[model samples]
Target: MDNFIGEIRLAGFGFPPKGWALCNGQLLPVNQNQALFSLLGTAYGGNGITTFGLPNLQTRVPLGMGQQGGVNYPWGQAGGEAAHALTTAEMPAHTHALTGSAGGATALGPANNLLATPAAGALYGTGTDVSLASSSVGPSGSGQPHQNMPPYLVINYIIALVGIYPSRS
Candidate 1:
């Protein structure tokens, strides 16, 4: 039966050794120890070598997700962690303040006199020119949201590798 062994041939400079041959049948010297090898039929397989067509490439193969903790694309954490969205209580206790009105006595008209002066801590901003600068200025109601918080998931991935095949065998 006819069989073939894939050969790695080299190109450029000098002739190949006696046993090897160029796919195109061109005689050349190939220094096995140092010569670059190409998957051409040129290299001599000698006695066991048979002549046959190249094999078809495999259709499918699996890839590593890098979660293996070994060298792989998208290298990072070996797996993923479970987590959920923060509830209203979970959110950092904080407040958002509104922009204060520009300060200036001239801005206040005759009406500025009718207002009474507020005691310390009772209110901020001057008469007539009273603005949102007051400590009371902020979102009202149970600014605390509903307790039913939605779920949150995180998957960290970055790099990807493709188009890799084994060398001739």
Candidate 2:
């Protein structure tokens, strides 16, 4: 008659039988979909993020000029863009605790540096850039493995995971 007692059950030692439904609980991994996606966002015989992640740009900057964001004629500007493209304003609310330590992680390079720019011609990161889409961090920011990233800085590792949800499902 009690809800707690009714929710407890142990199945026979075999695969779930057809027509039997498994009650849902909290999903184990925060990014459970990652299991279906590879490091590149593809899985189960599907095209990966590499194939669908980037937006087609007709105006990819010429060989040189002024800073065109990351493609301004410096480092190829890879590895750190896809994640910081959007602002926490656009992310889901934070509901968990943090799992890692940015500890003292600080933003490197200037706001004008190409590597610090998002490939979509956006200016943003865990650093200060007026044009940043999601330019803040800290335990109170937004979605995090556990807690929101620290404010005023974008830890290096979190910046890395932003792009590839990297799943196997």
Candidate 3:
């Protein structure tokens, strides 16, 4: 089949076939690949005068151009991180409830360590000022970045280097 110049496709093979170059963001001479340079320009990255760049698909997936659901994604735009660390604002709004008894014989419950006793006889103790201990749960996590990418299969993205030049309708 005759592929259009600059066309990109996934391949199971380890190397690109004849007339196709791996989309590894390598710079190409504009004078050498004029047809491809005309279509791709330097959107990926290049001086644009002597060199042009191929779309880099290494360890990355392609996303359709334009907006969807009010989110705009212009052509040749790259976004998203391989991993992310959640912030306090990103966490859901919720609270931890501490429950237990104090001053009574059964005050030695799980939450008794967090309970405080002020003024001995005020609650159920002797006529002495006794203050209980204050406790809290330690913060969790070691502050590491978690994988943010979805499950995906590995493949090579190859672009056509020699093919029919595509024209706008």
Tell me how many clashing residue pairs each candidate has: 7, 20, 1
Summed over model 1, clashes come to 7
The regions of model 1 sitting more than 4 angstroms off are: 1-83, 102-169
lDDT of 2 by residue, 1-169 (tens): 2122112233443332332222221112224334222332321123443231211111221132346656554422222222343467777987775453323323454353333323343344486556534536433445434533334421111012122233336
CA lDDT of each prediction against the hidden true structure: 0.33, 0.31, 0.86
Candidate 1, residue 36: the lDDT equals: 24
Model 1, 92: alpha-carbon shift in Å?
Answer: 1.4
Q: Which of the two candidates, 1 or 2, achieves a greater TM-score against the reference?
A: 1
Q: Residues 8-127, candidate 1, lDDT per residue (tens digit)? A: 333343443443333332232233421222333332222213332221111211244454557555511122223344446756888775443333333234463433334233345466
Clashing pairs in 3: 117-132
For candidate 2, which ten residues in a row score worst on lDDT? Answer: 153-162
lDDT of 3 by residue, 62-130 (tens): 999988999999999988899999877789988888664454443435453645453234545467886
Candidate 2 vs candidate 3: which has greater TM-score?
Answer: 3
TM-score of each model, paired residue for residue? 0.16, 0.12, 0.77
Model 1 compared with the native: what TM-score? 0.16
Off by over 4 Å in 3: 97-139
